[model samples]
Target: MNDKLDLKSTDITSLNIEKIAALFPNCVTETAEGKRIDFDLLKQELSTEIVEGNKERYRLEWPGKREAIVTANLPTTKTLRPVREDSVDFDTTENLYIEGDNLEVLKILQESYLGKIKMIYIDPPYNTGKDFVYKDNFAKAGNEELLESGQKDEYNQKLVVNPETSGRYHSDWLSMMYPRLKLARNLLTEDGVIFISIDDNEVHNLRKICDEIFGEGNFVANIVWQKKYGPANDAQGMSDTHEHIILYAKNISFWNPILLKRDEKQLAAYKNPDNDPRGVWRASDLSVRTFSENCYFPITGPNGQIHWPPESTSWRISETKFNELLNDNRITFGVAGTARPMQKKFLTEVKDGITPQTWWHREFAADTKIARYEMKDLIPENVFDTPKPSLLIKRCIEISSREGLILDFFSGSATTAHAVMQLNAEDGGNRKYIMVQVPELTTEKSQANKVGYKNICEIGKERIRRAAQKIKESLNQDSQDGKGLNQDSQDLFNLGNQENQANPGSDNVQANPGSNIDLGFRVYRLDSSNMQEVYYKPQEYNQATLDLFADNVKPDRTAEDLLTQIMLDWGLPLSLKIERKTIAGKEVFSVAGDSLYACFDHELDEAFAKEIAKEKPLRIVFRDNGFKDDTAKENVRQLLKQLSPQTEMRVV
Candidate 1:
């Protein structure tokens, strides 16, 4: 109970080494630095043929590729702290809006959301020379170092605009996308897919890396979307009117796309002029392109006019089948009953819905113009230069998944969150979302700053709030007007009818039927670890003073901050609703009934222990040095073991 918690993200390099060592122990060798794999032995184990390093192999590589991979594998000490004032329903909302560098945020989410995300849609920077790409880490350089390096200022900033004239423009952009994509792959479910919106600027490069990250075989389709209705006057050779959406599933074999409902235009193709009992139908050619001995017979219309097949063509069915269909009134001719025979195709007989095509016009998916208008409607300013329309994201949501967790790391204006809420109201599906955006500051001269939006996160959070309210109002009006949800409410799945349970890390929100729309979202900001570091030496400090008896937590941190770190360290979801209670003078935090219990308050004695043990939570934790002495800690541990043997107790 007195031991400290592991307050760091998972180290992927070490985890991979462990996995390899388990398979071939002999291949793993201990070095002065650390344990590493013997390439010769690993090659022999993997292949039956001789391995050669000079062999040519097809692959995409560039400067910083190795560094990007290393960056993805490295662990971080950063942690997310709750921002209650910025959140809506801080304790209950399954949705999340995180403000931080997405790379660090992705690492933090690795444990709690691994293989849990069902869909991802990110509209990342297109790297058009003007857009700033993440520079990864910012190093504060000294004046001498800056002078030696011929740089203007101290350590490079986190985001730097990449001009086309720069030597490594393309390489820099690729490196930035590589690590983020690599980490993102770990969060997608087996049947999940990612939809990335990109223009011609980096669409090809994006596809190449996507092939490397998500298997090439899993490449689904490249949808060409019409984003513009007309051409701009300042055109360079030709005006760009479309963009591409690259789709890739984690496992192509497991991919199951939800078919789109037929629109009015598609339905207009089917009609019944003669009023058939089987409902509206369309006529199909009764002739076959290939000649068949059994299907070459002629047919007589209702007016007793003999009809022959087109030149070199034959009847689609045999004489016996044609007679059977004729008896059932499945064959149709001209209204005058003097034309070639045709088969009646009933609209109700279709078992498969409309399969989406690779081409999407602005009418169906919406355009960037509509996106800007949407933001202006809520913000009343051109603060955000680029904002994807909620309908566009909703299209991706409907096709990729009907419910479950959705993620958008490059959540520019939180259009993904708005779409999730809007879709939930329309279909009554409890689809939770997590929007990760870097809190890059708005320009001082921009309208956003004048309106009090300090950063991009401020704009995003406000958009989500306003979008939620508008959606609720729209739903209310629709219900009152006797028009509940739109016709598409008949989507394949509606999770609101049953209990939705989250798993592995117990991030459960217990979303069930008859609940109001989950318009609320919890907000968390990334920051340094809450633990305080003690720098001491044998000559400077006594061993007794620096022992385990002392409190190592930073004074400024609250119990909630410590609990947030503890939750991440213990693989608990931050979205879980924490119920606070004072059990025998100590504030106890309970999550999901008896799933977890934590008391960060000081002086946790037998009274608090007994009260908590009665519930016998699955897991329990206490703050280090919270007891009077070692004896009290041991006694509480033993007492809990005797009373609640199944509970796993620890301290942080």
Candidate 2:
């Protein structure tokens, strides 16, 4: 995986560090706070030296627009910590469900997921004047300012408020979304596309910023989706029945939407009324709107009636083609034998699919009513307001990806994940998803709180678990009763309510295994770096701080936490298959089968290094204090070199 890395300018700070490390590996040493450059050692190595975005994004500027730019460029010391208790198939699942502020989460995933995501769909808050809790101000001067300013959620994170009465109502919402989108663009593949769902509140403003961020040429469409089946009887104003979904691609030239497959209702239009041996066919108008003197010929129907093109219109085909069609019995007349000639469109002669239109009806894309039904089917309580139907999101998935990575940063009830699972089950595809949601606390007076769902994340995770159970049960019932639901697995989107349903286990794809309809997702909560304390100066520092860090790595942090940090630092995906083993009285984690190896135990010797090097892993990482002394650290590296010169080793 680490063969000649691509020289792309992404995550500037980290990539430059890697380049420096390559040229002077000794200068790049691990500290308690993760990797750090050893300046003194680097000075020796150089004696000589070391070698190591967007334009006019402000087309329509808001109050906090500059702060939004600063936020996107800022570095985060935070890292994702694994939550095994809340996870399904922790070490095996390829799907990810992360709980954190999406802005920070986007920044953290930049390196690992950069330009890898195929499609992104976010249904963010509509800025409807509600008193929505917001993040700490990016432009605020200091922590004291935040402490004097906003409310802290259950997790103790500072949160401000945005209300209709506030002066910066629309500006606040735009600021919140700007940075997130800026970072998200980097995570998309060249052929990637993003769909954002918004209502009238900020749709116009959203378009302006999106045009600046994604570029005007990348603009695809502003689909008008029917969100309601009927109008509200209450006479407040014209009842709002529709919302907009804006589509944009990473590069317009590199991508195109997949045509929608013809459904049963559309296909039913065709029938073999004449019992033609060719196939079932439907009558199509054969007149052209534009005037063409050469195509103004009349046609003789099979019923011995003469037919002419409609008034002001000409025949679509030339006289020669019309004669050929007449000879082949491809023209049709009215059942009464007095109508004009029409062309017969055989089902077998047309394309298998139809191009999608900008207009989406509720029949194909479920409305708000069905969305509530789906939420009730799983939680049976009003945990979310204005939830989107899983089928609605499934429509987006169908248009976006057939088998690729899908991301949903504003995953409220996790409808995107639900849709992905249903689509994969139906087609036997190997699509994977990553859902990120902030653990927004439920108000004490809310139904979700009364039902014991403390936060939105709790509800989201529960929905995925129950949805998986529902899919698995459906598959099983089909196998037993032979109802053939497996072929029509999209029915799973219905996700019906069942009384006394037990939460069931899920399946995993491992990080590196062959893809499947993976039912499980790994859980990770964002937290500060695992480093307890780090030392800087080489001899004046290395030994003591390294020893202190090894002896204690954040009392609250576990070995898995350390492993995850290492994964991020190394640019290895956190989903890689990991195997835990104890060797020479030390705990070693084997990641992706010899791609990398790590041991954190104290007193590591040459023998232990030799044993591990026997397999010749691509890289090895060890805790600095894992060895007896400075002498022992050098000895282990030397031992590994003698045994497996192909292996790269590092000490933290």
Cα lDDT, all candidates: 0.80, 0.79
Q: Model 2, range 406-425, lDDT digits (tens) per residue?
A: 99999999999888887777
- CA shift at 109, candidate 2, in angstroms? 0.6
Instruction: Return the top candidate by lDDT.
Output: 1
Per-residue lDDT tens digits for candidate 1, residues 124-186, read: 888899887886642343454434433332222256777875646778888889989999999
The TM-score between candidate 1 and the true structure equals 0.80
RMSD of 2: 15.5
**Ten-residue region with minimum lDDT total, candidate 1:** 502-511
